[model samples]
Structure formats: C-alpha cells, structure tokens
Target: MDGFLDGLESKMRAKTVRDIRALRSNANLLREPHSKSMGEGLFELRVRQANGIVRVFFFFFAGRRIVVLSGFVKKSQKTPRSELRRALRYKADWEERFGHGRS
Candidate 1:
C-alpha cells in the first residue's frame, strides 16, 4: 500500500487515501470499483488513479477490524493468486492465534 501510494501523483494519491478511509469506515458501503470480496473471509480494496489501479488485500480479524495483508498495482485483468493466498495465510494466522468469530 505504501509503495503504491508513493508511485501515485499527489492528487490521485489523496483520492486513493480518501477511498481507503471510506472503506475503513464502511467497507460494505463501498464496493465494486472500490471493494471486492475474494471469498473465505478475504477481501480487496481497489484504488483507481489516473495512472492505473491499485489493490490492497485484507481480511477481517477479531472484532471485525481490518488487517491488511499485502498490496500490488493491477498489472493484468486478474488479481494474482499469490496475493489471495497471502491474504488467506494472514487470515489463517490470525484465526490460529485469536480464535474465529469472537465478538
């Protein structure tokens, strides 16, 4: 996420940041071009800039807090399998330590 932000023009970067904030506030409220569910409790946040698209993969851990796993700029029509695995691994690790669906 940091690297993607660093590569963006300031204005577009600011918009990306705002979109992320909107996601943090209400992830469900922001969808499609902004957020997507990748199944197995993992999701991705999409940030569009004039230059290109950026995606941050994350998962909901205990208390429904968002834990960002990894990020990459979109290079192809698909989100890489490696990125999804990374997010799932993080989700697994989190569940291992904290237990699942605790409220």
Candidate 2:
C-alpha cells in the first residue's frame, strides 16, 4: 500500500501532498458513512468503499495529466467539517498552483 501510495504521492508537488496522503489513508479505511464539501467547483468527494467511507477533494491539472490534488480516509461516520475545510484549503492551493482546468 505504501509503495502504491508513494508512487501517487511522488507525482504531486509540495502543497497538495498532505491532503493526498490523508485522502489515501482515509480511503483505505472506508466502511463507515461520510460526506464531502465543495466550493468554487473544487470538491471534497466522499464515497463508501468496501472498508469504509473515503473522502477525497481534488482539482486536476489537464496538461500535467495528474490528479493535481487528492486525499482520502476510511474512518469516521461523517466527514468532519474541519477536514473538509482542510481539503477545501488544499483544493484552493492546488488551483493556485496548477490553475484549474479540465481533468
């Protein structure tokens, strides 16, 4: 899991890394309920996977062919407001760095 996630992490620049890691870990744990928040088309997309619920927020950089920014989780019945806020912050940061475009 580390190797796969590390590969994914390597493609990201510094600003979005933390959120990506959180998202990946959270995704792996998904079996519980969750929700996501979004603003300005940037989103924290939460979904239920086999293990639990994963929350990921991202904006893509089309030219880069990268997710640009993403994060996930597997615990918690509801996605916390603070975490969603953090993901939103990261999404903003990603837009700032990469300039939002079609993903």
Candidate 3:
C-alpha cells in the first residue's frame, strides 16, 4: 500500500487515499475505479491517475482486519500475473505466520 501511494502525483495521491478510506467501510464498492475481486479470497484496490493505475492487493483476516499484501503500479489492460502471484505468496506467508490458515 505504501509503495502504491508513494508513486502517485499529489492530486492522485489524495484521491487514492480517499478511495482507500471508503474501501475500509465498504469492501464491495463500485469496481473499475475502486475495487474488485480477483478470485480465491483475494481482492484488489484500484487507484487511478493520469500517470498510471496503482493497485493494492489485500485479503480479510480472522478478525475482519484487512491485510494489505502487495501494491504496485499497473500498466496495460491486463492485471499482471506476476503481481497477483506475489500478493498470493504474501497472503500465504502471512497466514502461515499468524492465523495458520484456520477458519
């Protein structure tokens, strides 16, 4: 999340921050310019700027806290497989270290 926010211009950064706050209250907001499910239990928070698109990948934890696994600037229409893979890896690592993947 830090990485994604850092790469944005001032105006974009502000708008991104606002959208993220909204996501906290409602995970299933309007897609395209906000958030979307990426299969499994993973979701992506989308922040757009004229420069590019920034995405923060996250998943819910046992106590309903959002765990932000990875953030990156996306290019092109496709969400890069590598980025999704990294987020999935991080999510697994987090669960292993903490929740033990328990329900």
User: By lDDT, who's the top model here?
Assistant: 3
Q: Model 2 segments beyond 4 Å from truth?
A: 1-37, 60-68, 100-103
**What's the lDDT for candidate 2?**
0.49
lDDT of each: 0.78, 0.49, 0.79
lDDT of 2 by residue, 13-88 (tens): 2323454545544633433234233555554544443444444555435643334244555466655777667766
Query: Per the 3 Å backbone cut-off, how many clashing residue pairs does candidate 2 have?
Result: 16
What does the lDDT read for residue 98 in candidate 1? 75
Estimate, for each residue in 1-103, the C-alpha lDDT of model 3 and write its tens digit.
6766776788878877786777677775457657888987899988877766778888888645677787777777889999999999998899888975446
Off by over 4 Å in 3: 28-33, 100-103
Candidates ranked by TM-score: 3, 1, 2
Tell me which of candidates 1 and 2 scores higher on lDDT: 1
Residue-level error in angstroms, candidate 1, position 80: 1.0
- The residue-by-residue lDDT of candidate 1 on 1-103, one tens digit each, is 5876788778777877787677667875767867889998788888887787878777776565777777777789998898788778878887888788567
Candidate 1 wrong stretches, greater than 4 Å: 1-13
